[model samples]
Target: MWLLNGQSTWVNGYFYPGENIWAQCDLDCHDVDLVLYDRNGRWVAEDTLLDDLPIVQAPYEGSFAVQVIMAGCRHPRGCAVVVDSDYGF
Candidate 1:
């Protein structure tokens, strides 16, 4: 996992045949949604988990192409994201 500004995220380790991920903003608060775009640029996830945070998680058997937004009506003040990996380096 990696962080910028005050948010954290991670990229997919192994992608499926056709999978993608992304992070979007809901400055209007009209909808609560988080989606992972596929390799074809298609939003994949079905819910919004990063509405209050900038962290995105892949599917049960997938990874993610996370994002961090800097400007918005409801942005993060301070945050933390945790990713587990045993590839000790």
Candidate 2:
């Protein structure tokens, strides 16, 4: 969590198309951002606001990877976050 300014960690899963998926971390990981990529490593959707909650809509049915990046970490111990993700139509 407390690494380079652009450190990224990814979590992968299979999701159906035409649904909204979202991910969020703890308060301490507020500066972190979420990026959604398809199985082919194609960008689909992303939520990069001041808020920690990120949401994306899947354009196709396939396995996707959610990239969590530490845009900025103020905590001395870094930004260790527990991400909970789910999909819904």
Candidate 3:
């Protein structure tokens, strides 16, 4: 089993208006959960059982942070994660 964790360094809520933003996470898990939130401590989005090129798109044009947790009947030995951001359309 493996674990890979990463996130956007930009501060949420500091993003300019009308900014297009997106985040992509790569992971392999028997069972995994992904979550996103604003700097103000608001739940933005979440997903469960993410595997094989899982990606999440921001609903609004703003800054936010992402959190991912992996767990299941059998623990993951190893994994890899990468995060990137882009401007809003």
Candidate 4:
């Protein structure tokens, strides 16, 4: 989980294969984008739009990368980001 304090981007470097990744944003975050990248820096999947919901499944057994971007928001309390995966880290 991350508390985005006016920052629009966050990155993670550890993800497992065959694991289903999901990211949920706080209500304050109106628009958020989530993207998954392979070990080689290739885009695996991306989720955009308010209701699209960023979700991706690992393609192979290796460490992957994840990126979350806060496109728009309207809360003085900032936004919360929760990331989860099916497999144990």
lDDT (Cα, tens digit) per residue for candidate 3, span 1-73: 2353322132243334433333333334344455667767688666654353334556765667765554332
lDDT of 2 at 44: 80
Q: Higher TM-score: candidate 1 or 4? A: 4
Which parts of model 3 have CA positions greater than 4 angstroms off?
A: 1-28, 72-77, 85-89
The TM-score, computed over Cα atoms with residue i paired to residue i, of candidate 1 is: 0.32
lDDT at 43 for candidate 1? Answer: 61
Q: Write the per-residue lDDT of candidate 4 for residues 1-89, one digit (tens) a residue.
A: 54454355545556665678777777776666678887778898877756525777777777777777665557666677777778644
lDDT of 1 by residue, 1-89 (tens): 22233333434444443333333433333222333554555565544443533333444444444333322233334223333223311
| lDDT value, candidate 2, whole model | 0.68
TM-score of each: 0.32, 0.73, 0.50, 0.72
RMSD of each: 8.2, 3.2, 5.8, 2.8
Give the C-alpha miss distance for residue 57 in model 3, angstroms: 1.7
* Highest-TM-score candidate: 2
- Cα deviation at 39, candidate 1, in Å, is 1.2
Candidate 4, lDDT over the whole model: 0.68
Task: Give lDDT for model 1.
Answer: 0.37
Look at candidate 4 and give me any clashing residue pairs: none
Better of 2 and 3 by lDDT: 2
